[model samples]
Target: MTFKKINENEQQNIHDRSCMILVNFNSKELAAIKTVSGFAGIRDRIAVTSKNGNTKIKDILDGNMVDDNEDVWSEKAIIFNNIPTNRVTGFLDGLKKMKIRRPLTAMVTEVSIDWKLNTLIYNLKEERKAIAKGQFVDHK
Candidate 1:
């Protein structure tokens, strides 16, 4: 097997990377999450916040909920607060596991939320964010 050459940045990132607090929802997604929850290293690597019906936005945002070792890509990962992390990661996992029979597509959006086309953005801070259901048509 040929050895792959890793750049310095890539090597540094790998050393710094850690487990994540993943969130998910929906039928297929929920199933995958349940599986991951039983992992022996679950507590050390991943945190599941949306297993129950009470998946709150703040729970993912709260630094206290996640371990310091879970900061994989960035410092603090505060920007991920807008994501419905449970649904996205879980859904993707279901796709990989071939358990979700429903057809899915890459609905491009930065934030994961059940969205309406005519939705209003009351928060100027949040206006830059995108909705999960969006196809990115005419989206800025």
Candidate 2:
């Protein structure tokens, strides 16, 4: 069997091809969201709205986290916002495996969170398998 290598640029392109999903969860679910957000460049994409109506996730992860009450991550919060991609579904499943609630989005009714998240994981696995198969193909 012939083998091939994927270069850095190809890796970047593969990552770029992955899509992003904007997830919003109720304030009471902050800890749950933060725990799952650990997956996509998400621990960083995390953001929360303040009691006074200011958004703070970007600021906090950007090294602005402080002791100020206004900076409280859970202030009478609405919902945390995060943009997680296909790779992030691993953590989503982790929650499901443990029988915990998966973070719900403010969008996409009629479809369940499990269905949406599982679809992303399914597509990603298929893409990876295709790439792997190509890498092992004989090119003579």
Candidate 3:
């Protein structure tokens, strides 16, 4: 997996709208995999955006914050957005293997205190495989 820092200046749009970090992945590897899977023309590979401060994964996915339930918290939250479906499934599988609850956006604020700090930012090349089912899972 490869990690390349995006220029802060270039992320003004992302920053202005949300308290999130943005990272881009090389789609070449994903494109190759799609070819093998007979999805060669697929446009998107995978993208991730994380945010600190009180927030939920659902909010991130929906592009806005939602009312928190009694079991949820309002501070020091981590929100992971735009995770690919294959990756999400793999993550749930791994959690099941370790007897961890499937990560839920609603429960994240209640459970993970250092959500932003501990949340993964990037994984490229082989690391992607560790996180997802695709051949070139890159999250290192």
For every model shown, the clashing-pair count is 4, 1, 13
Top candidate, metric lDDT: 2
**lDDT value for candidate 2?**
0.35
Question: All candidates' TM-scores?
Answer: 0.24, 0.29, 0.24
Model 3: per-residue Cα lDDT at residue 57: 36
Cα lDDT tens digits, model 2, 1-140, are: 42222111112221222222333346545566556556434544333333322323333323344333343232121112232324344555655665665433221112212232333233334444566576432211
Flag the better candidate by lDDT, 1 or 3: 3
Query: What TM-score quantifies how close candidate 3 is to the native fold?
Result: 0.24
lDDT score, candidate 2, position 138: 22
- Scored by Cα lDDT, where does model 1 land? 0.29
Badly placed stretches (over 4 Å) of model 1 are 1-15, 24-44, 50-63, 66-94, 101-140
Model 1, TM vs. native: 0.24
Winner of 1 and 2 under lDDT = 2
Please provide, for model 3 over 18-113, each residue's C-alpha lDDT reduced to its tens digit, 9 standing for 90 to 100: 222222223553333334323312233223323222343333433553333233222221122333334434433444555533222211223222
